[model samples]
Target: MGTPLLVAEDISISFGGIRALKGVDLTVEEGQIVCLAGENGCGKSTLVKIVSGVYTPSTGTISIGGDSFNALKPRQAIAEGVQVIYQDLSLFDHLSVAENIAINRLIHDGSVLSNRAEVQRIAAEQLERIGIDLDLDAPVSELSVANKQIVAICRALSMDARILFMDEPTTALTTNEVKRLLAIVLDLKKRGMAVVFISHKLDEVFEIADKITIFRDGSKVGDFTASELDEVSLSFHMTGREIVYNRYHRTRTEDQPLLEVRELSRADNYEDISFTVRPGDILGLTGLLGAGRTEIALSLFGLNRPDSGTILIDGKTAAITNPWDALDYGIALLPEDRKTQGLFGQQSVKTNITSTMLDRLLTPMRMISGRKEDALATELVHSMNVNNKDISVLVDNLSGGNQQKVVLGKWIGTEPRILILDSPTVGIDIGSKSEIYAKIHDLAADGIGIIFISDEPEEIVANCNRVLVMHEGSMITSLEEEDLRADGIKERLAEIISDPDSFAGTNSGARVQGEQA
Candidate 1:
């Protein structure tokens, strides 16, 4: 409808034998939000990478402002004013806000020494212009997730990028932060910036996107106006088939609990919380951002300590003081933040696959033998169906699905009894999700108890046999086979959070901040 801001026609890219993107066509119009949606390994990231110049499409022609462009090199793409903010916030926590924001400009200016003062001024001005009240000199780690996110956006602005690609931009953002970010996006659009938002949250895609692009298996399926798409219809396109969007398929057994987390109190995260993840269970934990779903996983993984609590892994009390201990206790955590605790981007598949099991495989010298590591990695790669050229390839080079498979592989190699998948399917493709689902079934069939956490209520209902709903920092209620519906769970959680007196039954001291109304 409007003049295109950026366009790519017949884009193609290959990795070894795999055609990651095949003649895909996409565009972003000026002052518009066009979102691309699909399952992991569906070429969404590939397209974004090509547009942002992180990858040069093996073949394709691109134009920005109706002029030809190629992102053969990263600097070339940056100079061309195409910016990308990946799933991981690219801010350096040790750096000041100014340093992070003005990095591109300062480095581009070719200053022999860093221009700290000028960078600070420019960063502060950018924040001020965006109406965000952040201190320029503050260390990034000191800022909240929302503020740190703003800093990432400011850094993008410094590139003067006409088109910005945001991958899962609001994955961890609270509803309010999401609103603020959307407002900022709209403000940038009014100023004639083109934004390409990629996310799994369909509610967000429907709300902010003016146009939507659908990608399936390395090709663009079709494009549609936002008004022309709804969640069910769009899910069909993204998944390439009919998928019943049901969130309550829990089937709890009337037996003793498989896992009884009694008084699980992690200081400042959750307190005095008791819950059970039963066998053949998909314990659905839903809450707004910072509702402590992730913190709970971390404590279970032994990454963090609960001030006081009892974890009965299998009717037996267990002391899990660290990740190794958790693994030994048959508890494996697929961390919420994939980059932080999930993947080793720079490491080879072999290295990362056995990283979690080094203590188990290594001799007293603690050096993991290459043969043992290779054997474990090879087994996991095959078991998880990791599609890649070789086992030694860097995990980052693979598609999202394959990368996720590697993440799965790492955990499976450890072979814990309780497998904790925190948003394991986030930002991945349908086929990959199905594969992951099969893997989940396989793990369950093998009698591994699972605690699966996701924002998508539908995913929890369909894949899990039992759902546990959380609000603030407490597990409000558990959903059995009969009570696994999203609407039912949602209403229950809402009622619990809405009525303060109802919480008298629950004395959870840990608070959940920033939940959407």
Candidate 2:
């Protein structure tokens, strides 16, 4: 390995009596791709922020090249060739791609004039440097998630970044987009740039990381080469425990389905989709991005009303015009994007957990009873294994996994008989995922049907008794029982996605009524 490009020693930081990080050390060599793996709130972000000069560590030192500093400002970090692409990307949505890429450099150079041509020229050169092609004149808002990420990388290159840090970079991308981003990271490493990749996806980390650093509860667990770790071992290190997952088995109380959708269709989103979720069944919905998986869940939860469809709850046609209507019918949706669609981040965990069931906690006077609210929140949090000891803590203060738990708690507290979980475990650590899988199985055992939507085939294969595959906003096929192995599902999904025409004639014996390709 080459000389260390960046070295951090004894890094520690505290916020209002909470030690967010403690005595963490990290070293990244030139051309190294070091992946920081940990559960949310485990000091990964804290250490990265300290290293990138967004936060000055209460104690410790950072060394870049041959120089060491007790603390560095953001500008000083930039001057030392450090750049961070945060999860949000931090790009101006209204600006053109060229402007977003070149605006930083123009400001750093103190160029006051708004020069569109100059911006395009600089943006093109940066894109060329990275060997990525993107339209310079396209508005940033119009770019795909993948292209926006490429633009972000080009923007970092424009600043002459020697070491780059990408935080959860692929959380919002499609499978192909993730592959492309990993290739770009590899290309960057080949070009001798030290990269710190922070992510919860163990598959991506195993694919690209040269070195892996594990963190748990504000401290380093250990650091090892990627060859030294597998997914289970890596998960153990992050969570300080072994997580064993068992395949799901159906345990329904009745022969009839708890919820059924017939000929569901919505303009520009989904078409001719039909499915059924029996009591105690964990129905997996697998699809690529924009396959209308989320849209279907939304319609089921009454967030989006289908133009032509019938929703049957307990074999009776139900009219679900809004979330309230859905809840009244004992249906709940844990949306894909928890940060926006699920949790009120600024509110307390108790508030978020009880937000969905305010009516049930009302007193004789019809006023919200604080005691009843606290009791319900505490019960749900305890039952859901939420990691917070203090229920009054703001939801924003919790880690991503805990925040997700709070969201689940909120829905489960509503006493929903049918739950629609859209990417329920997205962006959470592996340990948390195992816990969630266990909880889902437990929920199934209690006769609450679940519609589990995710892009990951492994999750579907492991957790669902039945799986539905969607393509081009339609249910193309379904797999059940013996047909739900990972390899088989992956092969079938690949065939359908790669050549939809090949399966147009072959039914595969898994067709449902109103299913369209």
Candidate 3:
């Protein structure tokens, strides 16, 4: 390892009376990947903001490339080759890839002239530097999430960034996409650039980190070499407690099915999908990217229309052609991308919690009843264990886990018989994930059928009593009974997903459904 590229000592910051960061210290060496692990609101983002000059710390000293500054301005940080890629990526959606890569440099250099050839050359150079190939003329909106991430990296390199800070970079990527991106980060490290990574996913953290720094409750817990820490120990440091997860097993009280889909078909999306969610059953739906798991969820939620299918709720055929119709039929969907599709970030927590049941809170004058809304919000918040003392605070001000809880409260307020949670724990810390899993188990215990959709085998194995694997818009395998309850069920499901044919003839009661299977 080379000399430290950047260091911050005794970093402390506050927002009003809240101490966002307290006595946190961080050091990043050249060619090193330092992963910051913590629960949401544990000072990781605040530290990043302090380092990148977004927020001036109340006390600290930042030393970058042997130059010390008590406080750095945003432009000064950029001049020192510090670049941060936020979760959003913050690219121009309408601009071409080449323009998006070169525009920041052009603006920084105060260039007013249009030079298409120059922009393409610069973009090509950055892409070549990172060993990536992207269509220069393709608009940013047209790229996949993984491709957009690569573009963001290239753009950062175009600014001559010596140190890169990435926040939750793989929250939306598939396993394959995450592997590819990690490979690129390794290559960058090989070229002697420093990377500061922040993520809630521990497997990725252990895979890519040379050093691990953990924080909890606005304080730095400790920093250790990656070789000295494992997932359990790291999670303990992050949450200040041991995190234990038990596999969920359902105890059913009713034999009647809560939801049943027969011959559900949507061209280019999903086909011949058949499954049943019984009362108290947490059925898992999983597959790789574009495997139609989410497409199936959307169809059930009435966001996507199917060509031919029969949806039976409580043994009666129901026509759910829209979201309202689906809600009326006692179906609620917790969408995959909670930040975009689920919560209203700009709205207050109270409003977000009571959003789905506003009709029940209206008064005789047809105006919203504040008293009723407050009562319902209080009930849901307490039930969901949301950690906000003020319900009037904007949902955006809460942490990712809390925001997710609010979204859950919103959907639960509808009192649905069937709930579909699509990637509900993505980008959430281990502590928060455990709480959410317990809540899911409790809801199932209350006789609400759950259709859990995720790409991670461990999550599926831990939470579901039955699982359906999809591939290429087709149901490939069905695992139930002892197959789901076995000791190595997680590994078995992973193997099946990677190569379904290998398990096709096994005597484990696994059924191969589609032509691909």
Candidate 4:
């Protein structure tokens, strides 16, 4: 560690008589990586906002490179080389990648003319500096979530930020992309830059952090060296409880399959995808990003129109050309990106949870009944185990885990026979993940066929009874019952996902016979 580049002391803030942060102290030294870890709404974000001048602290002193201030303005913080890459990335969607990256510098430099070449040069230089390549001419809106995160990082580097704060950077990233991003962060640290990485992922924190800080209920719990803590201790500090996740095993039922897709093919998206999801089975779809796992799920949910296929729900041909048709055939889809596709953030929890079945809450005269809405919302909240006492609270005010539960409740209101959960546990904390896993098991035990989709091998191995591997828009292989029960299953599944060709000739225990051409 080098000299301290940024320090905040006695930080506390309040909004509407609610203390968002309480007496938190943080220090980021030059050439050091510090991880700020806590459950959602634990004041980690509040402190970062304060240091970056997005929020003023109720009482605190901030020192940037030994220059002290009671509270810094946004421009003042920028002048002191502080840059924050918020989760939203804050990029101009309509602008090209090059323009989005260089626009900040051009504006800061007070350039009068639109120098397109200069913008391209600056963007290219920053991308090369980070050792990541991206299309300069591609519009920001056209990039994937991972690429957008890289753009955000490159933009931060363009500002020559001495210290960078990344909020939940890896939440949307795949495993490989996360590794690359961590490498970039380490590279930045080696170049004498400070990084404050806020994440719920303990593995990444242990892999990259020099120091780890824990926060709980708007107060600092403790700060410890990476060597001083493990995941168990970290979880204990963050949630005040020991986190435990039990491996799930499917309960055997009769031979009737609840949902089946024969040769489901979508041009340029997925091809020859065939699978059978039995009632009360949590069948997982696992592969790298863009491996057609989500594409197949989308088709099943009627979000994507498959060019050729037959969908059998309860052994009957279901022509699901649209989402309404899917719903009519007793199918419910919990979409991948919950924020954009699932819940109404600005609405009350009652409104979001009961949004799917509002017609069920009508009065005798066919008018919407507030009393019925409240009763159903209360029932769903209790059944879903959502962490909200009041149903009227805005969904945005709840934690990420709670918000996800609200989405699940909304979909569960439909009471479908088949539930498609696409990355259901993404960005959720460990405790909540366990809870959600239990809920999934419960749903399956209730005879609801679940099509669980995720890129994480451990989750797939733990929660799934049978697993199918996809590669390049095709169903590559399926892990049989014995394969799912073997030791090192997660590692073996990961290997197959990383490279499916390696197991083609070998008796790898996985059912290569199930591989699709």
For every model shown, the clashing-pair count is 11, 0, 0, 0
Off by over 4 Å in 3: 495-517
Which candidate model has the greater lDDT, 1 or 4? Answer: 4
Query: What would the per-residue lDDT of candidate 3 be over residues 1-517, giving only the tens digit for each residue?
Result: 5799999999999999999999889999999999999999999999998889999999989999999998888888988889999999999999999999999889888899859998999899999998889999999999998999998998899899999999999988877788899999999999999999999888889899999999999999888988999888988888888998778888986979999999899999988788889999999998787889898889988999999989999999989899999999999999998888998889999999999999999999999999999999989888988888588999999888888999998998899999999999998889889989999999999999999999888898889988888887777778775677666667767766766555443432345332222
For residues 1-517, what per-residue lDDT tens digits would candidate 2 score against the true structure?
6899999999999999999998999999999999999888899988878877889999999999978999999888988899999988999999999999999999888898978888989999999987888878889999988899999999999999999999999987877778889999999999999999998888889999999999999999989999999988988888889878789988665879889888899998988877888989999887678888999988887888999989999999999989889988999999998999898889999899999889989999999999998899999899989988588999998878888999988888887899999999888888778888999899989999999988876687789888887777777778776566434555555455445544454433454222222
TM-score of 2: 0.95
Q: How close is candidate 3 to the true structure, as a TM-score?
A: 0.95
The C-alpha TM-scores of every prediction are 0.81, 0.95, 0.95, 0.95
Q: What is the C-alpha lDDT of each candidate?
A: 0.76, 0.87, 0.89, 0.87
Q: What shift in Å separates residue 168 of candidate 1 from its native position after superposition?
A: 2.3
Model 2's alpha-carbon lDDT is 0.87
Decreasing lDDT order of the candidates: 3, 4, 2, 1
User: On a 0 to 1 TM-score scale, where does candidate 1 land against the true structure?
Assistant: 0.81
Which candidate tops lDDT?
Answer: 3
Query: Which ten-residue region of model 3 has the weakest summed lDDT?
Result: 508-517
Badly placed stretches (over 4 Å) of model 2 are: 486-517
Residue 491 CA displacement from its true place in model 3, Å: 3.0
